[model samples]
Target chain A: MTYCVGLLLDAGIVLLSDTRTNAGLDNIATYRKMFLFEEPGERAIGIMTAGSLSITQTTMARLTDAIEEGDSPKSIMHAPTMLQVAEIVGGMLSDVTSEVSAKMERMSQNATASMIVAGQRNGGPMRMFLIYPEGNFIEATADTPFLQIGEHKYGKPILDRVIAPGTSLADAEKAVLLSMDSTLRSNLSVGMPLDFAVIEANSLEISRRRRIEADDEGFSRMSAAWSEALRNAFQQIDPI
Target chain B: MTYCVGLLLDAGIVLLSDTRTNAGLDNIATYRKMFLFEEPGERAIGIMTAGSLSITQTTMARLTDAIEEGDSPKSIMHAPTMLQVAEIVGGMLSDVTSEVSAKMERMSQNATASMIVAGQRNGGPMRMFLIYPEGNFIEATADTPFLQIGEHKYGKPILDRVIAPGTSLADAEKAVLLSMDSTLRSNLSVGMPLDFAVIEANSLEISRRRRIEADDEGFSRMSAAWSEALRNAFQQIDPI
Candidate 1:
C-alpha cells in the first residue's frame, strides 16, 4: 500500500508521498517515489507515484531518457503546457504498465501503477492531475482542492476538514503530512521515509523538498505535538 | 456502500451506522443498517451491518424471528455470553450469505456482508465483537477500542485519533459522527439518515437511540459547525 497526496491551493501546491513498497509482507523495501523536473525559471514539475514500483520506476526511467535526449518530443521540459505534460507522463506510465504486465502475465502478477503529475509551465498557472493506470487523468477543482492516490481512506477525514482552495502552501503541506501520518499508523502497507515538496506560486521552481525518515527529529516532535493537541481537544469536549 | 462503527468504552458502547444502500451509481435507496435486539434490562445487543443489504437484512430478520419465538437455540438473548451472541449472529449472517449467494449465482451476484455487534448479557461486561461471514469474530481490546465495517477508510482517522478505553461517550459519539460525515461527503454510496445508539455502562439496555435524517437540524448544525471549526483551525495555524 502507498499514500500519496497533492494539494493545490491559492498559495501553491503541496505534494507528499511515502517510500515504503512491498511485494508481500516480507518483501519490504524503500524506494523514492517522488521525482522533480525543473528548468529553473522556466518550469517545475513534481511527479509522485504509488502502486506497483516496477511500473513507476520504469516510467521514470523512460521519462529521464527522454529528457536526456533534449530534442525529443517526449521530454517533460519541452511539453508545451502542464496539461500536455500530464498527458505525456500518463502515456509513459500506461505504456510501462502494459509492457510490464505482459511479461508478468505468465506469473499471474498485476502490473498496475498510478501517478500524480503536478507542475506548472513557464506561461501557465500551476496545475495538478491524477493519472490512472488506463492513461486517463482528472484535475483538481475549486470544490476539491486536492487529489490523493494509494491507501487514501485512512487519511481522508483530515483533508476533507482542513483543505480548501485558499489554503496556504505551508498549511497544505501540514495537512498532507498529517494525512500521511494517519495512514502510516493505521496501515502497515504504508510505511516511512516520507517525501514532501512545496512549489511556491509563480515561482516556476521547486521551492523545498525533504525526506522524513522513520526517526527524524522534526517528524517525531510533530507527531507528539499533534497527539497532545488531540488529547487536549478531547479533554475539553464535554462527554455525554 | 455503508459505514458503521462500534466503540467499547468505559462510559458505554456507542454504535453508529449510515442508512444508505446502493446497487450502482443510479440505484441507491435508504435502508437502515442498525438492528437492535434488546430485552431491556435483561440484555441489549446492537448490531450494525455493512455490505450486501440483502444478506444483512435477512440475517437480522432471522435473529429477530428467533427472538420472537418462545423456545429456540437460535437466539441472541438465549446466548450464554457476548461471545456466544456473536457466534449466533455470525452463523446467521454466513447462512444467509450462502443461501442468497446460491440463489444469485445464476444471475452472477455476490452475497457479502460484515457486522459489528456490541452488547452486554446481564452479567457479562460490555463487549464488542466484529463478526466475519465465516462465523469468526474478534473482541475489541484496550489497544483497539473500536471496530468499523463498510466504507471504513474515510472515517478511520478520527477514531484512531480520539478513541480509547478512557474516551468519554460524548466524545466517542462525536468522533463516530464526524467520521461518518467524512465518508458521506467523499463517497456518494454512503449517505444519511443515520442510526445512532448509546448503551450506558452496565445498564444492559440502550440509553439512547436517534435517527439523524438528511434534514435533521442538529446534524446539519453539527456538520456546519465542524466545517467552520476546521476552517478556524486552518486559519489559526501559521502557514506551513
Candidate 2:
C-alpha cells in the first residue's frame, strides 16, 4: 500500500508521497515514488505513484526514455500543455499496467497502479490530475482542489476540512504533510522518508524539493503539534 | 457501505451505527444497524453490524428467534457469560453468511458480514468482541479498547489518538460521535439517521439509547462545532 497526495491551490501545487513499498509484510523496501520533470521556465511536472512498483517503475523508465529521444511525440517534457502531459503519462501507465497484469495473470495477482500528475506549462493554468489504471484521468477543479491515491481514507478528513483552491502553498504543504502523518500513524504499509515538492504557479519551476527522513526534526515537531492540537480540539467539543 | 463502532472503556461501553444500506449508488435505503438484547439488571448486550444485508438481517432474525424461544440453549439470553453470548452470535452470523454467500454464488456475488458485540454480564467484566464472518472473534483489550465495522478507516485515526481503557464514558461517546462525523463527511454511503447506545459498567442494562435523525439539533450542533474545532486546530498547527 502507498499514500500520495497532490493539492492544486491558487498559489501553486503541493505534492507529497511516502517511499515505502512492499510485496508482502516480510519483503518491505523503500523506493522513491515521486518523479520530477523540468525544463525550467518552460514546463515543470511532478508525478507521484502508488500501487504495483513494477508497473510504475517501467512507466517511469519509458517516460524517461521518451524524453531522452528528444522530439518523440510521447515525451511529456515537450508536450504542449499540462493536459497533453497527463495524456502522455496516462497512456504509458496504462500500457505498462496491461503488460504487467498479463504477466501476473498466471499467478492470479493484480498489477495495476495509479498516479497523481500535477504541473504547469508556461502561460498555462496550474493543473492537477488523478490518473487511473485505465489511462483515464480527472482534473482537480476550484471546488475540489486535491487528489489522493492509495491508503487515502485515514488521512482524508483533514484534507476535506482544510483544503481549498485559494489556500496558500505553505498551508497546502502543511495539509498534505499532516494528512500523510495521519496515514503513517494508522497504517504500517505507508512508512517514512517522504518526498515533498512545491511548484509555484506560473513559474514553471520546482521551487522546493525535500526528502523528509524518519528523524527529521521539523516534520516530527509538526506531527506532534498537529496531534496535540487535534486532541485539544476534540476535548473542546461540547458533549452530546 | 456502513460505519459502526464500539468502544469499551472503564466507565462503560459506547456504540454507534449509521442507518444506510445500498445495493449500488442508485439504490439506497435506510435500515437500522444497531440491536440491543437485555435481561434488564442481569446482562446487557449491544450488537452493531455491517456488510451483506441478507446475511446480517438473517443473523439478526435468527438471534431474535432464539431469544424468543426462552429456554433454548442457543439463545444468547441463556448464555453463561458475555463470551458465550459473542460465541452464539458469531456462530449464527457465520452460518448465515455462508448460506447467503452460497445462494449468491450462482451470480458470482459474495455475501459476508461483520459485527461488533459489546456488553457486560452480572459479575463479569465489560467486554467487546469483533466477530468475523468465519465464526472467529477478537476481544477488545485494555490497549485497544475499540472495535469498528464497515467504512471504519476514515474515522479510525481519532479513535487511535484519543481512546484508551481509562477514557470516561462521556468522552468515549464524544469520540465515537466525532469519529462518525468524520465518516459521514467523507463517505456518502454511511448516512443518517444513526443509532446510539450506552451501557454503564456493572449496571447490566442500557442506560441510554437514542436515534439521531439527520435534523437532530444537538447532533447537528456537535457536528458543526467539531468541524469548526478541527479547522481551528488545523490552523494552529505550525507549518512544516
Task: Give the worst 10-residue stretch by lDDT in candidate 2 chain B.
Answer: B231-240
Best by DockQ: 2
lDDT by residue (A1-240, candidate 1, tens digit) is 899999988788889999989988999998998898888899999999988887898999999999999978999899899999998999998888889989999899777989999988888999999999988999988888889999998788778878889976667777788778778988998989999998888899999988888988777766666666555544443322
Give the TM-score of chain A in candidate 1.
0.96
TM-score of each: 0.94, 0.99
- Tell me each candidate's i-RMS in Å: 3.3, 0.7
TM match of model 2 to true structure: 0.99
For model 2, residues A9-43, the per-residue Cα lDDT tens digits are 88998999999999889999999999998889998
Model 1 CAPRI rating = acceptable
Tell me the tens digit of each residue's lDDT in model 1 across B1-240. 888999999999999999888888899899988987788888998999988877888888899899889468898889889888888898898888889889999899677898999999887899999988766889998989999998888778768878889987778888888778778888888899999999999888889999988898777766776666655544444322
Estimate how well candidate 1 is docked, as a DockQ score. 0.42
